[model samples]
Target: MLNSRFDMKDMDLAHVILGIKISRTSNRLTLDQSHYVDKILEKFSNDDTSLARTPIDTSKHLLKNRGEAVSQVEYSRVIESLMYLMSCTRPEIAFVVNKVCQFMQKPLNSHWKKKKRILGYLNGTVNYGLHFTPTHLYNLTWLVTRMRTGHLIVMMRRSTTGIACFWVQILSLGNQRNKRYTVSRSSTEAEYRSVASLVAEITWIRGLLQEIHVHSSKPPIIWCDNSSTVRLTSNPVLHARTKHIELDLYFVREKVQQKN
Candidate 1:
């Protein structure tokens, strides 16, 4: 406080910080980094490149660089820039950015192409930003889903899990986690493991909300398409087939009982 000898000055408002632009109104707040995006596009000379419908092509196969490596240093720089943007205001590109970042050491042309595609996508969506508006908790919902284990990458044999938390219609967080499950006997086991991870994440979010003095009257509802896994979590009995995943079962079951 001024009387307490605290050093403080009132800045009327904040417009930009670290390339992110903040806009405010009576009832809404929006954040964007259009200028930063433009700089990246110009630096990469992708201003003239055609816009990509998606950030990265899903069908294109990018393997480890057995072929000649492209400009590894440049590729890493581009990826690093994009990563900061993704973590700040552009989470939509996280999946693709994460994918290409794995080959930073020995990036091939295919990897470079995907990296440029991300820049191209950004060029088309420079004005995009996150908008936060007043919303009621009753209208908000969270949905978590996962693919079958070993279904994402045939060679790696890992499953991909996705979580999308919505505050009413607006997305609060949308992200995916790549899970490597020890060879399981069935898809149900893999699905159950994924549920465990989802539960842990939800638990953390709940604690965060509580810290901020946000309270929900009712327990959060999670929708899982796997009925078998759902039953396994609720059932107290352990079956013969589930012995392999006893630890996961115990963790999920404890949370379920605690109404997480």
Candidate 2:
């Protein structure tokens, strides 16, 4: 953005391109820098770090340490850099990033090793940006003709610290998922839970998109492979099994019903 304005020495884009990721849609874009985290792994961690199945292992408990101390400076710098990414477009790393940052003031070798494990994860999914194009989004494969190109752009923050955020603007650019399962559960439970997990994210891009819409009359389109879930949401006749599910999962159903 610097070169076009007047004169800031057109430094090639390569320097700023810190081996992160870029996923694009007709209307928006997403940026992530997990690759640099991997580089940190190669530089500081072991090759055999166990891969975590999920970003945050809820079963794991981290206790406060009042043990032997290690140097805090390097730990601080690395943690700070990771925080910048976490606050911005790479919230997937927030758990690990925050965990690592916690040790910055009085770090330990063990804590440092944990930080390296995160880097190794970056080594694998270097370009895993979730490009959400109007065309790319198909909640259910049934509605294609209704799709239109949207106007959107994802501008992310780059303060090197603080919250990293995606400033998604929906102007007008665009004219603008699949799952198979054998389950006899309520349609709402199946579909809602199938959306991975909600706890991992603070706010979703869909929410951001809805915020930008010119009209609030229509609900966002959701396509589900499970017809039962659709039925559950549209017509809520709860049974024994579905009653066990959390009530918060109905947010989408409630909004959809209100025709939001």
lDDT string, candidate 1, 1-260, tens digits: 57469878788789999899999999999999999998888898454477877897877656774457899889989989988888788878877776788788888877777887887788789999889887676333566666543434335655566666665456665355464546555678777887777778778877877898887767776777888998998999999989988998999899879976
List TM-scores for all candidates, in order.
0.84, 0.42
Distance from true position, residue 90, model 2, in Å?
Answer: 2.4
lDDT of 2: 0.46
lDDT of 2 at 100: 60
Clashes of 1: 0
Candidate 2 RMSD computed on C-alpha atoms after optimal superposition onto the true structure: 13.1
Model 1, TM vs. native: 0.84
What lDDT does model 1 reach? 0.76
In the predicted model 1, the residue pairs found to clash are none
